[model samples]
Target: MFKNNNTCLAVFTGIIGVVFFSAKAVMVKLAYQYDVSPVNLLMFRMLFALPFYIVILFITRKKSEEHGLGVKDFIWLLFFGFIGYYLASYFDFLGLQYIKASIERVILFIYPTIVVILSAVFLKRKVGPVQILAIAITYVGVLVAFWDEFRIEGSEFLTGAGLIFLSALTYASYLTGSDFLIPKFGVLRFTSYAMIIACISVVTHCSLSEEASLSGYHANVYWLGLAMAFLSTVIPSFMVSYSIKEIGASNFSVLGSLGPVSTIILASIFLDEKFTILQMGGTIIVIFGVVVISLQKRRKHT
Candidate 1:
């Protein structure tokens, strides 16, 4: 009974974490209204969130060193960190400029499919029939939702969709590579270190790019940045990690399917994005496909 209660609590935590993560899109859209450049906004996000990770790194300092990871490992961490958080985040923020938050979430949720394909291609892993079926279902849903946006939102929609797709691809690559290191460094330690590396990358890019200055935004922009750093990034990162520890990754992934649905509702409430039948239907299909993939993955592990 205690274990059951713990699982329930973890499930609840996972759901809340996913919802907070989804809110990132709405917040990004809000910040854009103040004419804040995407890179600058991303800089603000990392800047605000950096301290928390720093603290985590400090807390895990002993364990981090105990791993005995070599310079090569650190280099790989830097590479994946740059690819995952820095580049992926930049692309996501840039893409948000051209797409509605709802459509963007749906597009981003396809990262698992990307991961599957990447594993098959790069790792020489076989793509089973079940995986192929899940991938097919996922893309069909993506097309349904994307085509709906493309038809209504006109030509610019393609640009946004493409950027978001790039974001998903890079993030999937990060996951694929990180699989090798997580067991060595531990989740919290690895996450904190990688995020710090990503923070450095974002700051450097912003310093060199057109969005160098991070000043002159409205009070609300700074406030929203703080909110995103805590609510969306820092808090949910830890929460989801805890949830996965308690309930397992497979179950945690099931909760992830709610991400787009929550984003759709939040976008409607906050960003005034339209909530359409097509979007709901597409989201449902995507969830079904992702859940199947998640289950298949669990079966493999067992």
Candidate 2:
């Protein structure tokens, strides 16, 4: 009974996390309408999100000492914080400037496949034939989605898709690294500390880049930033970490397939983005592939 309950909890958390995370692209696209640069937008997001992480740090500080993070742990946290949150988010924000939110979410959905491949290569985990099939199905879905976008948008789609693909790669790297560290540091502690590091990295980058002034934006942009900070950043971050803790990264990532669908729906409603039948079919295929992966993972564990 307890195991069943835990599974249910993980599923709920995963779904909610994916939904909120999906909102991020929509929110970023909306903020772009105000002429906010990606750097400035990311800076505002991290700035507003900074305090919540600090609070998490304080809450988890004492508990963290039970395991007692070492110099190496701190170093790893810093590295991943930069790669996972800072670099990935920067690339994603920049990419959203060029692509529709729906496309951006679908591209980002590839991270799970990236994570699976990275695990096999870097961690020496064996990828079975089933897993290989799952990966192929996922990519075919992505190609279908990409083809739809490319047909409508022309060659310009490549730039945004490439950037978002990079975002998925970096994010997958972060997840790969975190799989090792989350066991040592504990989920809440690791998430809080790593995000704090990401916050600092984002602030420093903004300071150096001079891309957009921090101040003097329309009040609406700041509000949108705050929404992104709370709705998309802090809440989803914790929920995802918790879900990973409960379900493991592979299963958690499979649940992330929902992200693209949620984003497409939200984009249609909020951003008035249109989707073709091919894109919709592609989204279904992607979800089906991911569901297959999730079922395989479950069977292996059971």
TM-score to true structure, per model: 0.83, 0.91
For residues 206-262, write the lDDT of model 2, one tens digit per residue: 889857587888898999999999999899898888877776665566777778878
Q: Per-residue alpha-carbon lDDT of model 1 for 233-262, expressed as tens digits?
A: 888876766665664443344456677778
Residue 145 miss distance in model 2 (angstroms): 4.6
Evaluated with lDDT, which candidate comes out highest?
Answer: 2
TM-score for candidate 2, please give it: 0.91
Q: Which window of ten consecutive residues has the lowest lDDT sum in model 2?
A: 293-302
Q: What are the per-model C-alpha RMSD values against the true structure?
A: 3.6, 2.2
TM-score of 1: 0.83
